[model samples]
Target: MEILQSAAALQAQTEKWRREGQRIGLVPTMGALHDGHLRLVQAAAAENDVVVVSIFVNPTQFNNPDDFRLYPRLPEADAALLGPAGCTALFLPSVEEMYPEQSKLRFDFGSLEQVMEGAHRPGHFNGVATVVSKLFHLSRPHRAYFGQKDLQQVAIIRQLVADLSFDLELITFPTVREADGLAMSSRNRRLSVEARKKAPQLYKALQLGVRLLEENRPVASVKNEVLQFLAMEEAITLEYFEIADARTLQTVEELTQPQEVALCIAAWLAEVRLIDNLLISAKSL
Candidate 1:
């Protein structure tokens, strides 16, 4: 696979592809290859004639400077995995390449940016939107693939696409997990062995939420059960657990007959912060 490290190089290749009428797919990710990310690449490759995977750990998205500093970067290993995973090209850009000037731009997603991850990490989504916009412009893919693990991120990006009128399909795949059910993530590498074992509890708690919602329990009760479940785990501290509307992401008080809702949770285990969510449909609820 050809590795395009600069925006000009990516645009030149993709522009040539577009002229030849080749269908293109873009999978945007932060470098630190894991099965989860490879899954995105595979899915993108399956549907499009040409696939471009952008690997750049965006500094703007990190709320904590330390977290940014600690984020993983394994370019060689990442490229190795992508070569065999059907990736046609890799868009590996640098911070300076992406942000040539000191960018003061910010994007607001209204209520979508007001809760859960957004509430905790100020300017996180703005940074996400900014970089994603840059990637979308640079790659100019026919479609973009993302995982369901970042439910809120998917939501935010969906909004960004619509508001900006980007002519591309947005595809979301299921969250890839380990055999033990821990959601695969770049940050998972930093987890202590014991913390890794405890990590699955987040998914387990999400499972409890799904069951409670299926039984038509009150939304608050379902949220409380998941919160209490996380609370009982000494090693994992609950950040926030909310049963929010799938579209608006506003926390709900009661089920009110099972509309589309998501059970989103975030927690801290040792130095790793993990987030997971389960989507509940009206038929299931």
Candidate 2:
């Protein structure tokens, strides 16, 4: 697999592929490769003639300076895994390369940025939208792959594509998980043994919430039950647990007309903050 470090080089190569009538796929990631990330690459490889994986820990996306500092970055290790996953090229750009000049523009995603991750991290989604918009333009792929673990980000990107009228398809793969059900993440590496054991409880709580919803329980009650479930687990501290419309992402009090919805949660297990979600059709209840 080829490793590219500049937008010009990546665009040049992809242009060649386009001339040859080859479909290009792009997977944007923040460099700590885990099974979940590889799963995205695997899906891209299955559908596209060329798969480009971009690994740049976007500095603009982090609201907390310390979290930015602590974010894991192992390009060599990430490349080692991608080499075997059939990736065609790795767009490994520097911060300056990505943000040639300090960007003064900010994206207003309307209500989409008013809740969940946006509420907690002020300019976080703006940074995500900016960097992702850059990657989409740079790679110019026919399709892009994202994981469902980041449910909110997936919604934002979908809107980004529609609003910008990007001609590529956005594909979302299911969240890859551990044998015991914990969602796989780069941050999972920082969890201590005990926190690791308690980590699966996050998924378990989501599962319980799903069951409650399926059983015709009220949306508000289901949320409380999930919160209580997590509270009982002493190792986990609830940050936010929301049951909202999957598309609009607005918290719903009642499952009135069987809309598509997601149960999303963010919590702290020790110093490691984990997020997970489950999507379901409330009509199926």
Candidate 3:
């Protein structure tokens, strides 16, 4: 796989691909590759003639300095994994390459930025938008792939694509999980042995919430039970557990009608922050 590090080099390569009439797919990621990430590349490779995976640990998106510093970086290992996954190119840009100067521009999604991940991490989505917009422009791919594990980020990017008039299809795959049901994450590497053992509880809690909701239980009651369920796990510190409209991400209090619902959760397993979600259609309601 070709590793293109600078923006100019990447754009030139993509332009050449475009001139050749080859369809391109872009998978943007930070460099700690796992099976979940490789699955995205494989999926992209199956559909597009060329798959470019960008591995840049975007500094602006991190609200906590410590989290930024502690975030995993394994470029060599990532490249080794991506090679067999059919990745055509790896856009591994440095911080300096991505941002030569401080950016003055910021993007706001209004209501989309008002809850859950947005509320907990102020200025987070703006930074995500800034970098994502840059990637969308630089790669100029016909399609982009992201995991449903980041349901909110997908929603924000969908809005970014629409509002900015970017010409590309946004594709999302279901959240990848371990045999024990823990959603696979790069941060899972940072978990201590004991903390790792308790991490699956997050998915279990979400599963319980889904069962209760499917049984026609009240939303408020389901929320309370899920909260109480997580509280029993001393190792996990729950940040937020929300059942929101799948598309708008607005938290719902009652299931008055049939609609897609996203059960989202974010919590701390030791110092590593983890987030996961489950999407279900409330047709039974």
Candidate 4:
């Protein structure tokens, strides 16, 4: 696979591909490749003639500077994994190349940015939108792929596409998970052995919440039960456990109507924060 680090080189290459009538697919990521990330690349490859995966640990997206500094980086390993997974190009740009000048613009998604991740991590989605918008422009792909692991992020990007009129199809695959059910993430690498063992509890808690909701239980009761369950796990510090409309991500108090609902949770597994969610349809319940 071609490893590109400069904007000019990437744009030129993509332009050449465009001139040659090749369908392009873009998968934006922050390095530290795992099966989940590769799944996105494979999905992109299946439908497009060329798949471009961009790996730049976007500094703006991190609410905690320590989180930004501690985020994993494994370019060589990531490239090795991507090349065999059908990636055609890797846009591994440095922070300076990506943000040649300080950004003065900020994005506000109204109600969408007022809950869950947005509420917990202030200005997080703005940074996400900024970098994702940059990737969408730079790659100029016919389609872009993302994992459902980042449920809220997927929702935000969907809105970003509609609001900004970006000409690309957004495809999201199911969240990939480990054998024990922890959602696969780059941050998973930082988990200590004990912490990793307890990490699956997040997924377990989501499962429990889903069961209760599916049984027609009250939203408030389900949340309380889930919270109590997590509290029993001494290593896990719960941040937020929300049941919300899957599309708008607005917190819901009841599942009285047939609609898609997301059971999203964020918690600290020791020092590393982990997030997971389950999407269920009230109709099915």
Candidate 5:
């Protein structure tokens, strides 16, 4: 696989690929490659003739600079992980290359980005949209792959494609998990052994909430039950637990018709903040 560090090189190489008529696929990542990220690349490999994985820790996407600085960068290890996925090229651009001048323009994604992660992280998704929009334009892939772990992000990107009319396809995979059910994440490394053990409760609570919803219980009642479970655990401090409209992400209010919905949560398990979610039809009850 080829490793490209410069934008000019990426453009020139992609131009060559375009001339050769090979379809391109782009996988954007924050560069701590794990099973989940590779899963995305694996999907990209299957769909397109050539897969391009862009490994840039977009500083714009992080509201916490310390967290951004603490993020792991194992480029050599990451490259090895991509080998099995058949990643043909890597677009490894520097931050300056991504943001030459300080970005003055920002995208307002309306209500779609205002709740869930957006509310918690503040200007986080604006940073996400800016860099993603840039990557979409730079790589100009026929299709881009993102993981379903970031459900709110998926909504924003889908809207971005429709509103901007970017000539591309967006593919998503289910949130991956550990054998014991903790969702896979690069930050999983930072968890102490004890926190790691308690981490799976996030998913367990989500599943329990789903069961309660299916029984036609009130949403607030179900949410409280799940909160009680987490509170009993002591180690888990709930940040936000939301059961909302899957599309607009507004509160379900009364679980209106039989539409699909998401139950999303963010919390601190000890010192490590973990996020996870589950999706089910509102009428599944």
Candidate 6:
């Protein structure tokens, strides 16, 4: 696979591919190269003639300095994996290469970002939107791949594309999981052995919430049920247990019959914060 390090190099190579009329796909990732990320690359490979995977651990996205400092970077190993995943190019840019200086500009998605993940992570999506916007502009791919592990991120990116009118498709892949069913994430590495063992409970709790909703339980009771279960777990501290409209993400009171509800939960297993979610059928209520 070709390695493009600088912005100019990425632009030049992408331009060459564009001149040749080759379809290009881009997978933006903060490296450490897990099955989750490779999944996105493989999906991109199937649909596009060429795929470029950008591996830059963006500093702006981290709310905690230690977390940013502790983030993993393994470019050589990542590049080797990309080659097998049908990636044509891998962009390994330095922090300065991405942003020589910190950017003063910021973007706001109104209420779409000011609750749940956004509520807890101040200025997090701004960093995400900014860097993603930059990557989309740099690679100019026909499509970009993102995993659904970060559901709110998908929501935010979908809004960004529509509001800014970017000429690219955003395809979200299903959340990759461990054998025991913890959602795959770059941060999963940060969990201690004890924490990892308890982590799958997040997904298990989500499953319970799904069951309650499917059984036609009242929205209030279902939410309370999930919250109670989450609270019962000594290791898992609940952040938000919400039942909201599928589209607007606004919290709903009643099921109101056949409706789509998003059951989202965020919690902390000690310092390792994790989010898991499920879509529920309104008929259960």
Clashing pairs in 2: none
C-alpha TM-scores of all predictions: 0.97, 0.97, 0.99, 0.99, 0.97, 0.95
7: Cα error in model 4, Å: 0.7
Model 6 per-residue lDDT tens digits across residues 148-180: 777788889999999999999999888898999
Model 3, 1-285: lDDT tens digits are 999999999999999999999999999998798888999999999999999999999999999999899999999999999989999999999999999999999888999989999999999999999999999889899999999999999999999999989999999998899999999999999999999899999999999999999999999999999999999998999999999999999999987567999999999987989998998898865
| Backbone clash numbers for all candidates listed | 0, 0, 0, 0, 0, 2
Model 6 residue 205 lDDT? 80
Error of 2 at 174 (Å): 0.7
User: What lDDT score belongs to each candidate, Candidate 1 first?
Assistant: 0.90, 0.91, 0.94, 0.94, 0.88, 0.87
Q: How displaced is residue 256 in candidate 1, in Å? A: 3.3
Give the per-residue lDDT of model 2 (tens digit) for 1-285: 999998899889988999999999999999899998998898899999999999999999898888888888899999999978979999999998988899999898989989998888899999999999999888899999999999989999999999999999999999999999999898898899999989999999999999999899998788888888888999898889999899999999999765998999999998778999999996798
Q: Which segments of model 3 are wrong by more than 4 Å?
A: none
State, as a TM-score between 0 and 1, how close model 1 is to the true structure: 0.97
Score residue 114 of candidate 1 by CA lDDT: 96
* Ranking 5 against 6 by TM-score, winner: 5
Error of 5 at 153 (Å): 0.7
Across 1-285, the per-residue lDDT of candidate 4 in tens digits comes to: 999999998999999999999999999999899999998999899999999999999999998999999999999999999999999999999999999998999999999989999999999999999999988888899999999989889989999999999999999999999999999999999999999999999999999999998788999999999999999999999999999999999999888566999999999987899999999999998
TM-score of 3: 0.99
Regions of model 1 farther than 4 Å from truth: none
Q: What lDDT, from 0 to 1, does candidate 5 have?
A: 0.88
Q: Write the per-residue lDDT of candidate 5 for residues 1-285, one digit (tens) a residue.
A: 999988788878777888899899999998888899998998899989899999999988898887788788888889988878889998888998888899998889988877878988988989999989988877788999998888899999999999999999999899999999999998898899999988999999999999998888898899899989889888889999989887788877568666888899899976677888899986656
